[model samples]
Target: MKWSEISIHTTNEAIEPISNILHEAGASGVVIEDPFELSKERVDRFGEIYQLNPDDYPDEGVIIKAYIPINSFLGETVEEIKDAINNLILFNIDIGKNSVTISEVNEEEWATAWKKYYNPVKISERFTIVPTWEDYTPVSSDELIIELDPGMAFGTGTHPTTVMCVQALERTVKKGDECIDVGTGTGVLSIAAAMLGSSKVTALDLDEVAVHSAILNIKLNKVNDVVSVAQNNLLDGISEQVDIVVANILAEVILRFTDDVAKVVKPGGYFIASGIIGQKKQQVKEAIEQVDFTIQETLVMEDWVAFIARKN
Candidate 1:
């Protein structure tokens, strides 16, 4: 099928609202290209970032792209999306240039375009996330390779939040430890836990798609024997006391369930909370503290934050 590609040249501040508008208008797989990302220095505790080409980014502002299936109402849908973005100004948002353009492309191209940007990435001292289609050889005997399709429902597990969570798990999980991964997404952390020598790992996600993807990736990594995948809400009705509970979800969501996490984590067990943007760092920290968790370490990467808190 052919798809219409819509590109918006907008401000960094406008990306979220504009992306929402596009998604509501039936867009799929929104991509953001900000020149700032080209120059942005990542906190490389996990891995080194190769320099991105500046030619791919606009000089003055960010560009947002999304694909919408070509249809009779394509014009109207695009117009509605533009109007919604322009409406953001009423809410005091700077829409920036707000220029929108459309081009047609094949479904195959749309599906494969983003895959080029994803390859084998060693995100931590022990963990390297590799796309299933790529050929990667480990640099050391102890290097742990995790394979996943970039098309996985939640993410490829190479995001900074997941990277930090895996790194934290490496630090906290001990031989024969029992671990729970709340909001497991593609089951990366649970797989990491199992590979890191956890005796048992429970991977949970509320999204059915995520559960299936995690199950697939878990088995692909050959850790299915040690890890179990389940469709579950954030630690709801969980009773098992485990040595570690790792959650790489939003700070807001983490704050909502820190108590539930606290309940299931054994005394002196660790909770790895990540997927927090810098703005919500303090609130998440305080929430963890309120749950009787003593913060042992706070890992920051770019605008994201993760905490390794031990249950008291």
Candidate 2:
């Protein structure tokens, strides 16, 4: 239940890669907290919100957190955890002039502290994702409801990139179309596709954690029969050509697998590509075009771009 908090200040650009490295190290998870998440108290007042837009939020910094189990620190006296934290700090300083702050959390309260941050998030017009602990009753017109408790996986549809993908899904997926959600983080899009009447769905991700999370979410929405979950990459090791291919991943990876994405979709199939910054959209578009696909539409959210293309 005990946790250690280590905050690292780095560029929003560098946080993900560094956080991935930290995850590979020993950190269970790293929350790339926007400084806006930080709150300050006002004199003689209830909590007054600070209007800190992520755009205005300093792009040159990030807060990296790693939790250490209290039992391990107390009973076994694990110096390795401390060493790993120090190593992360050293690594960041060597790579860049970033700073880190480290602290410990009370064991008993650490487990539930994150709950305060994970609340009900309404994703789209027809769908709303609520945490398991939060009470929510969908209106009569609510077409779909996905419940989650983000257990050891990502994708609550809050991240800008993920939200863009979901929006793209809303636009492209139609009744009875087959959908393949590549990098199916937390199964949000796949379930959305199913609820949107994707006749058949296949969800794939290289991460086993994502695959497991996808399966659980798909079942939670009772869409297991419509959506099949698998662990794969860019349609590899799969033979079906879907009507829609949704891959929300880094631009580098998407361009690398552009041909594969095109091949995995049938002629006239929809290809929804997301997770690319505005500057990288041209490269992705060229890659898609090189593979005989044409961009039908583009959606921009913040600095990120999502392309809905068609294999012609």
Candidate 3:
């Protein structure tokens, strides 16, 4: 089988949204080549090795690449992805140099090409994301490992937004707490919640593909007994109150259904909201406050922000 490689040249601010667009358009695997990573300072507290190639990245801006089967509908799908990306402008997102290109490759090339970008990285104090293909040894007795295949899902459990959410979960999730993970993606946060001692976890995602992926991942990490993966849109009709809720989604989506989130969270429970850009931090914070959630803490990494809010 052959695959089409769709590449988009955009800014860092547009990475999350544009990658999401590609995923929604039936792209199975997405790779981000950000030039900023070449010069960025990283503090690796837990001895994890990183293999980066300066030649693989662009000179400026970020390039997002996704692989989709070269099927009859590939043209239509690509056009829809472009339209969806253009729509991000309505949210006041800067999509600098939104140039898109396409190329073709064999299935073998597509299958192994993106693996080079993923490695074992300690994203939080206790949790480290290790791709299934890598052999990594834990550096600490208390270190937790999350094995992810990533596949074609939007979340690698390694993105800064996801990293912040898992880190916040490490700090907030108590033993035997009931947790709800909205837009669970790869179910990384739900697995983290379960690993952190949440007795029961509900992992929700509107995308059926994501639901399937999450279920597989939850099983892969042996957390299926504690985590349940389901296809649901945000927090819409969820009536059962949970002890904690975590959402690593776009800030605009958070603003749309924060009230619903507030409804499902038990009193004094915590809400960990992430996938917010730095520029939209205040807006998301104000929206969460409007839903009667008191901001407990705000975490920022690079240009992304995560908020831990509590219901009073």
Note each model's CA RMSD in angstroms.
Answer: 3.1, 7.1, 6.5
lDDT tens digits, residue span 41-160, model 3: 786655665867899899989999998889999989988988988999999999999999999999988768778878888988899998888998988899999998777778778788
lDDT of 2: 0.74
Q: Assess candidate 1 and give its TM-score to the true structure.
A: 0.86
Q: How many steric overlaps does candidate 1 have?
A: 0
Model 1 pairs whose backbones collide: none
Which portions of model 3 show Cα errors greater than 4 Å?
3-37, 43-49, 55-104
Best-to-worst TM-score order: 1, 3, 2
lDDT of 1 by residue, 1-312 (tens): 999999999998998888888888887568899898877766556455656878899998899999999999998998898889889999999988989999999989987888878878888898888889899889899899999873547888777788888889888989999999998888888888999899999999999889988888988999999999989898998998999999898887988898798889999999899999999999999999999999999998778999999988
**Who is ahead in lDDT, 1 or 2?**
1
Comparing 2 with 3 on lDDT, the higher-scoring candidate is: 3
Predicted candidate 2 versus true structure: per-residue lDDT over 69-116, tens digit per residue: 544443232343334444655455432445656677886576677777
Per-residue lDDT, model 3, residue 4, is 90
The number of the candidate with the highest lDDT is 3
lDDT of 1 at 304: 92
lDDT of 3 at 100: 98
TM-score of each candidate?
A: 0.86, 0.73, 0.77
